[model samples]
Target: MPNLPLTLGCWDYDRVQALMDGRVRPEGIDLTFLNMVVEETFFRMLRNREFDVSEMSMSSYLVSLTKPDRPFVAIPVFPSRFFRHSCIYVNADAGIDSPADLVGKRFGCPEYQMTAPVWIRGILSDHYGVPVDGPTYVTGGEEEPNRQEKVPLDLPPNFRVERIGPTDTLAQMLADGRIDAFHTARKPSTYDGVRVKRLFPDYVEVEKAYWRDTGIFPIMHVVAIRREVYEANRWIAMNLFQAFREAQRLTYEGLKETAALKGMLPWFNAHVEETFDTMGDDFWPYGVEPNRATLDTFLRYHHEQGLSPHKLSVDDMFAPETLEEFVI
Candidate 1:
């Protein structure tokens, strides 16, 4: 049989650019790449199984594991990783000087179960002594209206979450004093002025310290294949995983070739060198073993926050083929 053609959905990130441009081809597969906004890709995949393979929110993926019928299975190819400390924005007039000050305040999130907010919530509770249930949570769209949670959540009674009406975005709520702070993966539109500022002004320093302490560069998304597809073509998982790793390798090489600086930043090379110094040679790693710490912490957060019905081990998230590779 010929290599099966598959639709792969993801954001147009540099790491996945090579795959989309046909520079990196998965063995025994004809991939048709669909580059779109991450939210669109995730929503479509989860709600409708819109693609043969797609990028999915890690938190959402964990929660899906608890369901009776999960439509997708993931590989360890993490397309998006970020530090959530900088995702938090607080109103200047809210008297929130630190994560500790967030207690007893009203805070907004794009979604409570979204990957970024889950990481932010975990950081606040673990590092800064801010309890997850301490603040009232307002859930709504960050920039647009009429956004809804991708999965159904059975939050505990102690957790307080209020869904906003269609007229309001979380950004407007934070700026108008309806909420004291907001957390969104993307900067809220209201942050264009002084109305909103990050709770941690020196987030870069704080995030670096956090990484040094925890060795977790919070994973936001994992690449998943439709369950039906994976059942029929199990080898495709390893093939895709290897192809993604190759693409990531290309991205890292691009970051180091500053002789003719590919990006516009003047201090790009200095930053790249510092990143390798701080994060080690493999800055954005792809395999399951290398990212076990981050995976464990994220799963714990998901279960504790009522996003997942049970605590999921790292082994439950990926294909059996991904757990081992043939040595050449």
Candidate 2:
């Protein structure tokens, strides 16, 4: 029997390098790995259902479920995760000395529903006591202009989402103090230390403390399959999941080969060791079971921020094929 032909749209990550280079093919799928930045991939996938499978914004994927047009179902393959403490940039003159000061300020993000901002907003509210509904959210492009949300949202009236003018980009707005704070995945070009600064300049220590206090390593993206494709070919889910897992396994093994230092970092192995000490062996775990707390927290954030109609469980977001693996 011939293998199913599928295309996966995702960013160029070390974990999925094997898949892109044709070294680790899915068990029975001919995967054409479409390499692109996440924004393009997400915009295309959400707008047109462009690929058979793709890295989707986790927050947006949750919102998709509430829409009657249930376009996609995801496996528990997370291609991107980040500690979002460094993602918050604020105008130097905005008088936002701390998170609490951010209340009543104009906060800008690329989209009200993007995953990075969702994580940033949640973290600030939960840890810093800056209410989630406090900031008047300004939404538009970060570098370009007039960027729109991937999915249409029907948020509650209390949520204040105001759009920037067609020509206004959040990057420029933050520099000009038109928006007091900017939270997005990519750092804006205006992030000069003097004009635009991170809310926590010492974000490394702060993020470490955050992890120590709360075991939440924020997740940004998940690999999702178009519902039409998934419904017709259910077995493809596990095949792809196992393939992604194997690819990550290779990357993890590569991260430890300190014989000559595989990466550019001089003390790469030291950092890896420190990471292992802080997080466990399988630090960057990909599965519903290990990530239940993280996913559940994100679901709560999605619901609280009004991006999701209701809080969804781990089972609600992932394909059942990825929930467990057979023991040898």
Candidate 3:
């Protein structure tokens, strides 16, 4: 009997590197891992279903569920998580001194449905009183010109979203004060601090305080298998899930090693300690039950913002096999 062949597309993270290097192979599977940055992987996967398994934006996945013939089914493995406070950038001339000041200003994003912006908008609306529909949204390329939304959106009538010209870039638009603030996952090169600065200069402390208050570590990306692939081989869901979990466990072990530093940061250990102190040992958690609140909150945001028709439950987003485990 031959092992089933599969291909996975995702970013090159230390956590999932074990799988990339062939060290954490799933049982009864022959895996081919394609390591790329998130943007390309996401664009390809959403546009074409390029890989058998791929990294998907949580917001986009929710949007997909709204479609009658959705393309993918996800496991609980979140390869990427981020604090989006640092993702908000504002022009110096926009009179936006704080998050609250941005109401009625021209807010820009690469796309309204991008995961980071959804989390950012929801957090700002919930915490800072920045109304979700307060600003007129300008969407287009951030660095390059003419970028389009990977997934199409049919937002509510109240929300105002418009696109920039084919030759226009949001980085230039932001620098020119045409757009007051920008919410994005990738920081544009035009951000000189004097011109375009982060909305939260003290974002680290602010994010820590947010975590302390809310206990929600925002999940940025999830791993998904194409629906056809998943349907044909349902067992692959748990096999891949367990493989990813092992890879993440290896990552934690490597990060906690005291013998020598893994990367350039001298205070990596201190940062790790601070994370544990703040969020506990298993800070980056997987599975449905442990992440219910965060997932539910995101779903609520997705629905309210008109990306999802209804708020999807945590159980609705993940594979059933990954939802439970057998105990001794």
Each candidate: what lDDT?
0.90, 0.93, 0.92
Q: Clashing pairs in model 3? A: none
Over the stretch 45-89, how does candidate 3's per-residue lDDT look in tens digits?
999989999989999988888899988999999999999999999
Q: After best superposition, candidate 3 residue 57: deviation in angstroms?
A: 0.6
Where model 3 places Cα greater than 4 Å from the true spot, the runs are: none
lDDT of 3: 0.92
Which pairs of residues clash in candidate 1, taking residues 3 or more apart in a chain or in different chains?
none
Q: How accurate locally is residue 220 in candidate 2, as Cα lDDT from 0 to 100?
A: 91
Q: lDDT at 102 for candidate 1? A: 92
TM-score of 3: 0.98
How well is each residue in 1-328 modelled by candidate 1, as lDDT tens digits? 8989999999999899899999999999999999899999989998899899999998888878888887789999999999988889999899998778999999999888899989989889999899988999999888888789998889999899999998889888888888999988899888854788888888899999999999999999999999999999899999999999999899998998967986778888899899999999997889899999889999988887878767889999999899877898
lDDT of 2: 0.93
lDDT score for residue 265 of model 2: 85
